[model samples]
Target: MTATRPDPEIPAKLLAWYDKHARALPWRAMPGEPAPDPYRVWLSEIMLQQTTVAAVKPYFAAFTQRWPDVAALANASDEDVMAAWAGLGYYSRARNLVKAARFVAELGGFPETEEGLRALPGVGDYTAAAIAAIAFGRRAVVVDANVERVVARLFAIEEPLPGARKAIRAAADRITPDERSGDFAQAMMDLGSRICTPRAPRCDACPLAADCAARGHDPQRLPVKAPKKVKPVRRGRAFWIEREGCVWLVQRAPEGMLGGMRALPDDGWSAAGDGSGEPPLVGAWQEAGVVRHTFTHFVIGLSVRRYDGAPATVSGKGEWWPIDRLDEAGLPTLFAKAARLARAASERLL
Candidate 1:
C-alpha cells in the first residue's frame, strides 16, 4: 500500500471541511482557534483510551473541575483522585495519571514534542502523538482508532487491524498537512466519527469521498478486524463483613489489577483462575449472590458472601464504612456491585 494515495490534497480538503464542522467538545479547541490547554488535551486523551467521547464527557468535566490544572492534580491525594475516577473501567490509567501529573508539574510544564511527551508515566505512542499534534501545533501523524478507519478506507488498505496499522499510519502521514496539523488530525477524527462511520458511512457528504478507494464498495469493511479469541472465565469470591451500620473496606496493595483503589476485602483474587483464598475471618457466613464482570482479556464471576456472626468478628487493617455512604467510597465497579448485593441481602446494615 503506497503512503501517498490519490493525491496530497487530502489534508487541505479535510481542513477546509473541519473549519465549519468541528465538534464543540469541552476539551477541544475549535478550528482556527488557539490550541487548547495541554493539560486538558492530555487528560482527555488518557480518559478517551478504550472509552467513548459520550462516556468520557462527564468524567472529563468533573475531573477538570476538581483538579483544574496539572499542579492541582499533582497536589491531589491518591485516594481523592482514585475516588473521583471510579466507574471509568481502566483503573491503572487513573493511577498513572497521578504519576504523570506530578512528573509534569515538577518539570514545570508539558513537553511540546511527541518524543518528550511519551516519557510521561502512562502515556503511550498514540496518546503522545495526539497530544503533540493537537496541543502544540506539531506536524505529527495522529492515527487513533478513528483515523485508522479513515486512512484505511481512503487507501483501501484491506489488511486487518493490529498488522495494518503501520500501513494505515504511513498513509495518514502523507495526507497530514504541515500547517494546522492539529486541525488536520482533528478533522480526520471528525470525518471518521461522522462521515466514515464504521457502519453505513455517509460517503456522499465526506470531503475526501472523491479520493476514497473504498467508496461505493462497502467502505465499512475496509478496516477489517481480526477475530476475537474466546475469553477464559475465572471464578472468585468477595466478603461482606458488616457491624454497627458500617461495612469493612480495605485498600488494595499498590500494584497489579485495581491497585490503590479502596474496595471490599476479597479472597486475594484479581481475575485469577486459582482456588479461592480463605475468608477474612472464621464465621458463619451466608452466600449472598454473585457479581459478574467482564474485562478485556477475561470474565470473572465474583461470589459474594456475608459474615453473620453476632459480633461480626472482624479483624483486619480496614476501615468501617457507613452503609449509607458506601457510594462515596469509590469502590471500583466490580466491588461496588458486590457491595450492593451484600447490602440487599442484609437488612440490619442500613
Candidate 2:
C-alpha cells in the first residue's frame, strides 16, 4: 500500500482549464475573494444534490434572499420555507435544511470538520467532503456524478455505477492535489461535466488526454454504467372538485414523495394496488380523468375524481382555492397535471 501523489502535470493542466472554463454560478465565490459563507455553500450543495445547476440558481437566490443566514433559516416557519421551496422538488431536503441550519446555529455555525458536516441532516460523506474541501480548503476528495465519470474514464474502469463508486473515489484521491485541493475537486467535476461528458467526450480538447486511460480504449465507452431499474407503476385517486371557481387543494404529508406541497385531495397510494379506503371527496365523485407521473423509484397512475357542490375545505390544514388562482398555490408538476385534467373535464361536462 503506497501513498499516491498528485500527477505533477494534472494540477497545472486542470487549474489552467478551470481558470478559463469555470461555470459562472451565483453561489461560487470569486477566484481571489474569500470562500463563500459556509452556510451558503452547505445549503446550496444540499439543494444541488441530484439537481442541475441551472435549476438551482433561482431557488438558491430566493432562499438566500429570504433567510440570508443560518440563524434566519433556523427561525423561519416551516410553511414559509416549504412555500419558498415549492417548485424545487425534494421537499424533504428543504425540511432537513431548516433542521440542519437550526442545529448548526445552536452549535454556533457549520462545523469545519467533515465529521461535523456528516452529522447534519441529509449531508452524506460526499457532500461533507465537498464542503470541507471547497469551502475550507481541506484536503478532502469530492466525488459527485461528474467527478465519478471523470475518474472512471481516466482509469478506464468498466464496473457499473454505485458498485464502481469506491474504486472511483480511490482513483480521484490519488490524483487530487494537496495544495489547491479545492480547485482540483472543482476541476474534476468540470472536466466530467463539460469535456468527458456521458455520451460524447471531447478527448481532443481534454487537458488530461495524455494520462487518460480511456484514450487508448474508447473515451465514450470507458465509464460503463449498470442498467437502470425500471420504475414500478403505482396507482391512486385524486379528488379535484371545484366550488364557485375555487378548487379544493390539500397539503401532502411532511414526508415521502411530493411532501409539503399543495395537491388535489387524494387517498393513500401503494405499489401493489390503487388507493386504499374511502377518498376525501363527497357528493357522487366522478372520475374526471387519469394522470400519469413518474417518480425516482416508481411510476404513478392517478385516478382524477371531481365533485361540484358546496366547498368542503377540511383537508388537514389546507385551503380552498379559486380554481383560476391555482398558480398562486405553488403546486408541483404532478398536481399541475391533475389540475389541468380536472379543469378540462369540468368544462367539457358543462
Candidate 3:
C-alpha cells in the first residue's frame, strides 16, 4: 500500500512543543543539544523496558557509577552485575546486558545503525530504532508504548494491539520527519505520557489537539487492547536453614528462571512442582509461613519451611551467608520476600 505523507504541520508543531517542555531525563539530551552518548542511551533503553522511569532512575545511576562505560561493564563479573540487579525483577535483562556490553566492547564501539544495534544480544526493534535516532541522529521511526498510543489516537486507528501494530507503525512512519527524528520521537513519548495520558488525556493542552482524530470521541478507547489471558498460580516451598547467625543459600542453575542468582534452597518451585520436594537434609521441619510473589507469567505461593535440626546437617553447594548481611547476597525478589518472611517468623519465636 502507498504510504500517506505525514501532516507537514505535525513535526513543526511537536518540535516546537518539545523545545519548551522536553523531559529532563539523564539519558536524553536537551532540545537542540548534541545527542546523548550511545552507551547511556542504550543502557537506559534496556532498563526502561517493561519498567517505569521512576523505577529505573536509581538503578541507572548506580550502574553508570560502577561501570562508567561499555568496557567497564563488559569486564564486570557476572555475579556482581546479577547482585546489583537483584531487585530489578527481570534477571535475564541483567544477564543480557552483560553479554551485550561484552559484545560491544569487543567491537570497540556501539553500532551506529538500527540494523547493527539489533544484532546485539538483547536489542530489539524498538530499542534499535530508538538508539539509532536518539544517539546517531538517524531518521528511524521509534514507536514505543507511548508512541503507539499517540499514533493510534492521532490516526484514530481502531484495531486492537499486536494485530494493529502494522497500521500503527505506518501511521508513525508518516509523521516521522527526516531531521531531528530523535526529538520528534521523544516528543511523542512525552506527549503521550504527560498530556495524552491513557486514562484521562489532556487534549486541551496537547499540541496536536487540532490534528488528532480521536479528539471528538474517547481517545483512550483508541489503540484498543486484546483481551488478557488469566495468569496461573503455582505453589512451592523454601527452606530456611539457620546456623550460627548464617543461612544456607544456593546459586540457581544458570539457564532457568532467576538463573545465576543466590537463593534459598527450595522444592523446585519454578518447575510447577507442589511444595513437597525433599529438603536439603533430614531435619525437623516446621511451617514458618508463606510468601506470595507474582512473576510475569505466574503467581507463586512459596511455603517457607524452617529447619529445626543441627547446623552441621546442612551440607550442599551453597554458602553460609550471615543473616545480618543477607541483603548483600543479591537474591531475586521472590527469594528476598521469602527471606523476609523467614526472618519475621524466627523473630516471633524468640
Which candidate's lDDT is highest?
A: 3
Residue by residue across 1-350, what tens digits does model 2's lDDT show?
98544467877889888888887678777555577788888988988899988889998998899899999999998777877787778888888888998899899988988988999998998899989988898989898988888888877888977789888888887778787777778778878878999888989989899887778687777567767888778888887767787877778877877787777778888555668636674478777788898777888898888888855555566677887767778788888888888888888997
TM-score against native, each model: 0.94, 0.91, 0.95
lDDT of each candidate versus the true structure: 0.88, 0.82, 0.90
Per-residue lDDT value at 168 in model 1: 86
How many residue-pair clashes does candidate 2 contain?
A: 3
Candidate 1 residue lDDT tens string, 56-123: 99999999998899999999998999999999978899999999999999999999999999999889
Task: Evaluate model 2: give its TM-score.
Answer: 0.91
Segments of candidate 1 deviating more than 4 angstroms: 1-4, 274-277, 308-315, 348-350
Candidate 2: C-alpha RMSD to true structure equals 2.5
| Candidate 3 per-residue lDDT over residues 1-350, each given as its tens digit | 98545578999999999999999998899997999989999999999998989989999999999999999999999999999999987788899999999999999999999999999977999999999999999999999999999999998888899899999998899889999999999999999899998898999899999899899799988789988777788888899998888888999998789988999999876645456667878868878888888777778888898864346646668888898988889998888888888888888888
Clash list (residue pairs), candidate 1 = none
Which residue segments of model 2 deviate by more than 4 Å?
A: 1-6, 276-278, 311-317, 322-325, 347-350
TM-score of predicted structure 1: 0.94
RMSD of 3: 1.8
